[model samples]
Target chain A: MAVPATRHDHPPSRRAAESARRAAGRSLRLGFLLACAIFFGLPVTWLLLAATKTQTSIFSDHPLSVGSFGNIAQGWSNLLTFNDGELVGWIWNSLYYAGSSVVIAVFLSVPAGYALAKYDFAGRKALLVLTLIGMIIPTAALVLPLYLQMNALGLLGTPASVILPLAFYPFAVYLCYVYCTTSLPDSLLEAARVDGASEATLFFRIVLPLSKPVIGMIFFFSFVHAWTNFFLPFVMLSDDRTFNLQVGLMMLLQSTDAINAEGGFSALPIHQPEAALAALVAVAPVLVAFVFAQRYLTASDVSGAEKG
Target chain B: MTDTETAGRRPARADRQGRRPASGAESTVEPPSKRRRRLAPYFFVAPYALFLVGFGIAPALYGLYTSLFTDSLGAGTEFAPLGNWGEVLTDYRLVDSARNVATYVALWLPSMLMLIFAIALVLHARPGRFAAAMRFVYYIPGAITGSAAALLWLFMVSPQVSPFSPLLDLLGVENATEAVSANTPLILALMGIAIHAGGWILIVYAALAALPRDVLEAAVIDGASSWQVAMRVKLPMVSRYAALILIATFAAGTQVFVEPTVLATGVPGQISSTWSINQLAYYYATQQGDFGKAAALSLALLLVGLVVALLVIYRTKFYRIDRGLS
Candidate 1:
């Protein structure tokens, strides 16, 4: 009875107008969201679907058909058997390089950034300026110089060549600086000092423990940068055994670089399906890290990366 | 009075005060002695600082030195200042590389921002699990490495075995080359880049999240339509975040590499051998063994990168963290 009374309390025309407005807003929102899903989400969907199908089935009349999971297994097998289990070596190398770099950067860059943020030191401003420039400058600029360095030291064929340059993570240092300056409290440090705690004691016991989130963020960022690094490793590491996944991936892509004179492509370097699987392999670590780290990688983390 | 103790040494303040550590004590615990407080920072930073100098500053200076000399076939390293720079600047491959990158930035910057902005706004409007899941999905492609994304998109563009071959054919594209042809509505090269560029979408969504709820409700209560509120209020509020993403994108965009190189496979002469400026430098250094030329080109790119960064630092002023352009 109350609902009926309330329904009639407002004029019918006005109620209808309000309902129309609400409906319009809802549609606008959902429609744009649907477009977003199709735009951003569709390619991945197409990729997964295409991966499940046999290469021949892809172009049949029903290209989007639900193909069997067996195809993925087959693709996996093919990738393994190609060139005497080569991709495994490359994947291992990528993990080693990216992992080692992340460890070094997390340990080193975190402290460097902390020093910049918490301590008033001479040359800090100069270091900060250098970091900013290092970040903005493209990775391409460093590859040539590093190659010469590696060449001059006679370390070109070794993993150390790539590992050394990756350690110079200026961007991660800056990220840590921004995170600390904003989130960390100077009062706590001064209080610790007043309590007669040494700087090392204060840092290890208090500051390092509180800086976990930023460290995680820096680890993942550095990991991704090193993992996807193609130019440096490409220039420095020529041995197949020393190649990271990105360089190996480039090598795989190169096999297909030549186009046919008859207006078509030759057989893909690897089967098309296998290439997708390799791509999946290449990105799985990043995706896993994201799933775990997204808990800590908030908007501020991105802002630090973008605006730091 | 004198600088006697090493900088690494800290003052044993706890022992001097004769104070307990507020807890259990260990005999092995030695108090720190400090002489130079300011120098203590260098201790905190020395590990990474070594990297900064050995890998960063030293190599950069070394690059400049390398750029000044040429090592050619049958000739030892000869001093020829600006020689390599002069050659590479006039090289058509370098010219085309720069042109292609400029064209790509022009195409990529606007569409990328608009796509990301729209998606962010829509997700902002609907605050729910669905939006969150969609954001996660959007970020997945970005996690994929550049070479992998290129391969994935290549499969999509390949007319021989792609699910979207029909749609591509409808667009009159018969093959991967045509699908990515500069004239095509959907450029495959840009598509590879756009997919990898989805990381910014989350940043924008977060910006939108910071919009005050009460402000929006007030706009609605004041007789403003939903459309008007979004257009006027939300748009303006998030424009700063959008601008930050744009400037960063512009700086990164000029260094485009992996996307063009990987996708250029399907297209023959339609794309150049050295499709990107980075790849051109790589080719000069590694393939041609012209380290001087590569270094020269890299320095040039570095100058441009610096200029772009300066534009953002000075022009945008968004770095003033306290104010936040709001």
Candidate 2:
């Protein structure tokens, strides 16, 4: 009777011990995660708060406190009217460059990917290898050559300088290729062909409709890359009028001392709060886009790119 | 009605012909009409090929040619063979830039890896609705160009007007100048970059998620804890992804231009003009007009990029998988 009772007791004791261990592990993980979150989150959180603070209060007050709501509007006004509206122009240039590049990149990459996956042809292997090599080479290393090429073509200081180079996003092509090869099967293409569809008809009518998610992913990736790019535009464009947001921000940082010396309210443009507000403005579009498309941008895409 | 009937007739013919080997029927149905179809692949690839040859291959070759000679920026071209390479190899600024790059890689790579891996593990172990949201938030900075992100960090770290003034005060920093002084700016800049580039970590996290669940389940069943399974089982399996990340991060980190450029304004004499190879090249090209040396420096960076790329290709078996051609 004692042995039976002890055996029953043994199970509960083991169960209790396992639960305790799990709870401890869970708490430890959560603590580590929370700490990391705060560490990374603090700077961004500070930026959000600073955007609402007036320039004087930004320096004197508690750093994390939200300022009067009025400061947010004031900051927006300062950012807009700064240097006769150069900030707004810079933002528009960024959108133009990134948006056009994304559109062109998708058009080229999707068709190329579809062709590579569905068509059996000679030199396919070499083309795929070229795509991989293109993806691996750093964009920084290519900037000089690209600059010289643009200069030779008399396209320097033009938006074409940024837009044209960005259009050749090999990574997107590779991603589309992998997505098509895996998610799409050869049998479907064969079926479409058997139904008397021409190659163009098959691609447009069949493949592209099924490829919306991957297309969105590629657009987002390319758009973000082009938008955030600095080195290329800095090298290519000489005029501030043609500058994108990244280049414009650099110009602002460089000229902050001059602005401070001017002393008038209009001349003393782009103080600390305004700078933070501009940075927020710069990243806002990308943040909004990411939020909307967060579901499709999964790890599977990353792994699939590698494995495929 | 005619279009549907024509389409319906084609499939029936295809079905009948597919069952039997009909060389005659195959020609009539699918028409090997022109050799253009045979050459279409190369035609599709020509523009990119031209780009590779013109921009990539030619300039790389030209850079090598220029690096071997010495020429002044303003003066007409004159060749002093292998002189610039020798001088650059021994120049203090070049040496310092190399050291800075090395220090940056050492500090940046490990921190980036650790933060990314830790966050990924946490994300994987307990995925919630907020996990995706957090990933998107972190990645947003990456989409902001390097200059903009650097500019954002400048505001956040400036002691005088930083919203994180209290945090900086805790660290004993008094002003923006002191916060971005020479001794500490590189470290601060690196930390900012690591945080800003955190979105790439999602790539590694995705790789982790795609690991066969059975392998992890086996480890768990065999009395392994989550940490142990992550460390011993998962980490080793995903070593390829880690290596890929390291190589890429190392390459990108070496090309540090904008961070140093923006930060240099705050600390002028401390960070020299030619602080990085890219900056040095820019100086030679635009400021000094020494296109030869600039070309040489660009070539040197290109070589480094190639070696790094080749290392990735060799180790990761990047293009080893056989798709079709045996």
Candidate 3:
């Protein structure tokens, strides 16, 4: 509770002490807020400026200084001409990979999470444990194994190589399990069941609609996971044509004229500002998605869902 | 899935304190011949189970098997059972990578928690449009992909183009590489990680939001200082959420790849390049063409991540059937 400023009875010294303490706390908070603004706000803002700067100005200009719209245009055009619009293709590939994986994960994870949470089945604990294990395992650990498997199946470098591995989002499944168990009242499902609704019908018609927010939340996360992923696609696809934005960015970074080990710029097409532009390109969709999902994913999204 | 079976059963689980106590929620009576009910769950679980087999279990098994064979990165595998694992255990780069990661966790795991915790506390301390707007601004970067964020931070850390260049220059930072020096890339990479702190601030804020209004008011009436309320009352009240963030964030640190990889991209030698475990594994898988070693290193990271997560789960009883971990 906010303290009322009525110090009607306090001694003058004590009142001064209380006000001093209150003022100190206020400054401490303000200081923290300012620190946060710098820590959190500085880099993205810098990147925004970097995106607008000309390639040469990237080295010459002050880091945070505003640049021309011409620089933004040039950065983009440079990115386009780099390997003949290769970065744009990577952007498309990332959308496809992330989009498809989200689709598969949402459809499958919801049902599976429902099953694990709602049903009392043999081996359910084992299933939960399996999901937990899968959920906790690092993506790095899975890359080599999946690479070998894909290679064995002769699917390496294909879209499936990345999409399939990314599709198994045990974390989302666990989230769904938690959602269904904690938030979805068993009564709602039972009512559907009592009405002679088939399991498929109940899930498709009832559970799916009821769980739209969680689904959106899951889709948003799954898309982020796939879209931002570097290692899986790094190992799975060798072809430059199939690369996601992260991998493509890496490739561009390596070839960027700014970072070339030798003195003068290399014959490589990509450069510092163009790479920055490509990076912005990759992050654009995610920003859009976050905007759309912001309402669905308020602080109370998972935990607060139950309150509603 | 068995959305049908437990469609109405909270029996033993209905009493925990949360948004809704399970006690009053109507649970369905189990029909007889629920013996057949066991089979129903398998149907719902099949999709996840299938994916687990294809993507999780199978790949992990294959990784283990691959780790037993050296030079498997190439077309041919030369079976040297445990040879790669031995190398992984004794490699100098492994030690360096571990130290780098440990240093990073020490820096990152805490800073991430504390920084976000502080913001979370501040925002929760005052609820208004300003806090909400700040929360939105903070989380917008959460949507920025890791590599993109890294690239963005690369700009900030780069003294040449950074807006904070004057401040960084005043601190003796001459270039991005110097900013994320070989010895201490932790700070540089953290900026990239910190940009995503907005969502977590909201998360911790939400956890704080769950604190009962009367309890806080009672503390205030007791003449508890604002600092005491924050430290003694609010902090303890939200410790569970803080712990969750702590454990999850630490687990995530083990997988830190993009920031380091992107920052170290054309740097000569192992300055910031070989500073993380994933980088080591990535070098093996991609550069060195040693899938066996990569697989071994990946397993090491996986083991560490899993252990941390499991420890948190155990400590928090997050998986307890009743009294769901907030």
- Candidate closest to the true structure, highest lDDT: 3
lDDT per residue, candidate 1, B33-140, as tens digits? 333344678998989888888788777777778888888768888899978889889988887788778877788877787777777777777667787777778877
Candidate 1 residue-wise lDDT at A5: 46
- Candidate with maximal DockQ: 3
Q: How are the candidates ranked when ordered by TM-score, highest leading?
A: 3, 2, 1
Pairs clashing within candidate 1: B9-B33, B10-B32, B10-B33, B10-B34, B11-B33, B11-B34
RMSD of 2: 9.0
- lDDT accuracy of residue B244 in candidate 3: 51
lDDT of 2 by residue, A230-264 (tens): 87788898988889998897677556632233323
TM-score of each: 0.77, 0.77, 0.79
Docking class of 3: acceptable
Chain A TM-score by candidate, in order: 0.80, 0.78, 0.80
lDDT over C-alpha atoms for residue A95 of model 3:
91
Q: lDDT of each model, Cα atoms only?
A: 0.68, 0.64, 0.69
The DockQ of each candidate is 0.32, 0.25, 0.40
Across residues B65-169, which tens digit of lDDT does each residue of candidate 3 receive? 888887743567688887898998888887888887787777776667777877887887887767766776676666655445555655666666667777777
| Residue runs of model 2 more than 4 Å from their true location after superposition | A1-10, A110-144, A173-216, A235-241, A256-268, A298-308, B1-69, B73-75, B79-81, B143-151, B155-176, B182-189, B192-196, B206-243, B322-326
